[model samples]
Target: MNSTHDTSRHIGVHIDRPVQEVYAYTSDPTNLPAWARGLAGAVEKVGDQWVATASALGRVVVSFAPPNEFGVLDHDVTLPSGVTIYNPLRVIADGTGSEVVFTLRRQPEMTDAEFERDAGAVADDLARLRDLLESEG
Candidate 1:
């Protein structure tokens, strides 16, 4: 539970949109591939759980926090190998715009290079989200 003890990277981007609007779009699991390149291949819902066909990880189940007004977009991704990754995401109001933050946790088996790569991927995704949302504004 101690995030300080664990290795993690926090990446975020500022979107030129209101918090509510940003949350509405990003909170939807179906929109993940639009910004998340790792999951850009395919995403579908099966019953209550969402499954994503990521190029590097293959098939994985994705679970998100229940609908709420707090702009908490936290999600968990379960890999085919049964390893579940907790991704902490949030959309916070900043003036008239919003900031989307994604915390990337380094897996126990991952090397430093892999962890950096994951962080880079998250940065890229967040930037994509910013561009998509801003351009729509």
Candidate 2:
């Protein structure tokens, strides 16, 4: 794949927890700081959206999909530049546990290194989530 076009990569992890429980915890914006390092170390509620006042991309706003039965935790993160990136995430049943999958889409202008870094970040975050959830059991 060339850097001139967009690319989609799926990063996932298997958490030793029920799908519903994983979905409930992950779907909440306030719980993001504990696992989603790519988002921010902290987030605040601003009106109906979650705002990260200090992030690598500067201040950003996050909006999540309403609660749903399909385990979808999709969200949009609007950067300081006002460019909103759609993040597709899901927690699905994996026997007694759950599998969290995050679709990381590389922007058209991102270089190969940047794309890989973003993918790595997602992988790390998912691993963190898995660790946090599995330890609870």
Candidate 3:
């Protein structure tokens, strides 16, 4: 469901559950680590603010959300250059299911290969979410 490139990446999957449940799971950062493969743990508020640490990707604190629809995160990944990563997670409802999009734009000096690698990581995370939800049912 996820992809990477010089172009924008889109990752989506159809869940059998209601849109609200899917949105709740994604919007609540505390629940993120339960399904997100990249996150080891997260602390978050109900309305959608969070600070999280990824087992492999380091720590991140979500900075803002515009109109409660999109989130911007200030993320730090421990790498050689120690660069900051900006990630946006958007959620929208479509009919009976929900659509989630993860967009990443890193430091200007970041290479396309680096972007692709991270994008692929995002895809795997989403896939893990799908498995979690389906398994629960």
Residue 59 local lDDT, model 1: 95
Query: What is the TM-score of each predicted model, taking all chains together?
Result: 0.93, 0.94, 0.67
Which candidate, 2 or 3, has the higher lDDT?
2
Residue 65's lDDT within candidate 1 is 94
Clashes of each: 0, 0, 0
Q: Distance (Å) between predicted and true CA of 68, model 3?
A: 3.7
Which ten contiguous residues of candidate 1 have the minimum total lDDT? 1-10
Off by over 4 Å in 2: 1-6
The list of candidate 1 runs beyond 4 A from truth reads 1-6
TM-score of candidate 2 relative to the true fold: 0.94
What global local distance difference test value does model 1 have? Answer: 0.87
lDDT for each residue of candidate 2 in 36-99, tens digit (9 for 90 to 100) = 9888788999887799754677789988899999999999989888899999999999999999
> CA lDDT of each candidate?
0.87, 0.89, 0.60
Q: What's the CA error at residue 72 for candidate 3, in Å?
A: 10
Write model 3 residue lDDT over 33-86, tens digit each, in one string.
777756546655435445666666566554444334332232333332454455
